[model samples]
Target: MNLALKDIRHGLFRFVLTCFGLGLLMTVVLAMIGIYNGLVADALAIVKAPAADVWVVEAGTQGPFAEASSIPPDTRDAVARMPGVAAAGAITYQTLEASHAGRTLRVYAIGYELGRPGGPEQIAEGRGIATSHFELVADRKTGLLVGDTLRLGRDRYSVVGLVEDATNTGGDPAVYVTLADALSIQTKLDPAAARVQAARGAEPVKRPTVAAVIARMEPGADVGLLVATVRQWKHLGALTEAEQEELLLVSVVDKARRQIGLFLGILLTVSAVVIALIIYTMTMEKLKQIATLKLIGAPDRTIIGLIVQQALILGGSGWAIGLALILTVKDNFPRRVELEPFNAIVLAGIVFAVCLASSGLGVRAAMKVDPATALGG
Candidate 1:
């Protein structure tokens, strides 16, 4: 009773090959979606990890992520001493490549004060940083084990703990170091550069600097008051948690997000065009059979059903194959590719809608088949 199933069975091998090819395309489209989500997750990981009520940065600038903003290291102490501030910590972030096991690993170096708000909220393995220097809590995605020793500029560090899904906006794995260690790395110049600076009568690098200050408020503290206090400092600016997240998601990565959206759009358009072309070709290949069916008095709806059923089968098959492929290889990517079930479901539904839409070309062609052509044959 199902003409589509009969036709597919008649060319089972070709049909399956077609499905496989289409599956690969679907995988690419789905991967793009997953990648965009992963980018957001990575960019926000640091923003959310601190769980701070307010962020204080250089006045008139968005902190670390959007733009460079540095404050005096002692600002942490000053902010902590503020009226509404229960606790404050100075943190710094930068990207660096470190040698590990004969490979260079790109990592986001974070300097957090001990007993501070900037430590990761969750540890997936071992323990968090406890020592004042040369200890690290690294993201597991860095391919680091708990006991692995990593060498950063002028120092060797031991990985004490591992966190999951922690990365900078650029998708580099995050590594935590003590404020002192980070300060040394930041200020220590090449020996030659330091010698030249000294000869040039350059002032020695003063106290260490921090990228931003994270603060948590006392119970029922007025955030407006804290913001007002921070604003008055003349050298500091503050953003609430909501404002920080918005700034990162909207203002920071907006361009990259739009580019990814455009890429996804192009991919969808290509998919639609390919599906339409394949269906149109399949209908053309079966023109003689279609003409015979028309001569036998089959209705237009039956022919339409045939095209729709075939499209659904192709779409479903490709979706299944693509999902399996993506899941299998997602971990192999350098950056995180988070393929959530909900996202997959939504994509599958959209794919089906596209498949139906693409079948229109074939349906129209099939409907125009002439019975007289079959009689001539």
Candidate 2:
């Protein structure tokens, strides 16, 4: 009684094969969207991790996450002494390659004042660094395990703890060590270079300072007032959490985000064209059958329903398979792939609309089939 059902049942293998192929394409599209979300999320992770209200960095330079920013380490004490400042800590960030366990690891070294504003708020395993020297809390993605010895600069450090998903915007794993240790690695003079400077009568290099200051506000404190006060320093800049996030989104990853968006648009366009072509081809193949049905007094609506049903089925199956694929291997990806529920819902809606629009080609072909041709044949 149902012509669409009967047709699909007769060509079950082909129908399923088409869906499988379409599913693979949809999976790729979904993965790209997930990657974009992951990129933005990872970029903002450090700002979110600090849970601070104010970020103070060198004046006229965006923080290191967006660009190079360096400030004196002693600025933390100055900022802490300011009115309405609940706590202040110095944070230094640098990208370094360290050798550990016979492997080279690229890590973002963070210098956090333990038990202060700059340290990670929570630890996933073991304990936060309790010693000032040679202990580290590293992101698990670094493949670092507790008790593993890492050679950073001229000193050796032991991984004392691990955290999950604590990666920098570039997906590099973060290694949290004491402020002193980070300072040494960040600006530690190359012994050979230091000797050369000494020979040239240049004073031996002193420890370089931090890149930024993270500060928390007291309960019910006015952040605006605090920032205005800090701005008077003339050599420093202060940003609230919202401002920092905006800077990252607009400055740090804008091009990448736009690039991904353009790719997604192209993929959707290609998908629509491919679906329309497939439906149009299928409709052409069944011209005689459609003519016969029309001659038998079947309505145009029935023909339209058949084509639309196939499109919907194709798109729906593809979406399901794509979602499944993203879930199965997302965690294994080098960079984070965050597939949120809202993203899935929006993608599903897009595919549905595309399927409906794609059916237009088949609808036109079916509507043009002549009932007279069936009687003559």
Q: Please give the clash total of every predicted structure, in order.
A: 0, 0
How good is model 1 by TM-score?
0.96
Give a tens-digit lDDT track for model 2, residues 74-187. 999998988888999999898889987688899999998877887877889988999889999999899999988898988999988999878888889999999989988876
Best by TM-score: 2
Which regions of candidate 2 are displaced past 4 Å? none
At residue 130, what lDDT does model 2 achieve? Answer: 96
**Candidate 1 global Cα RMSD:** 1.6
lDDT of each: 0.89, 0.88
Q: Work out the TM-score per prediction.
A: 0.96, 0.97
Find the 10 residues in a row with the least total lDDT in model 1. 199-208
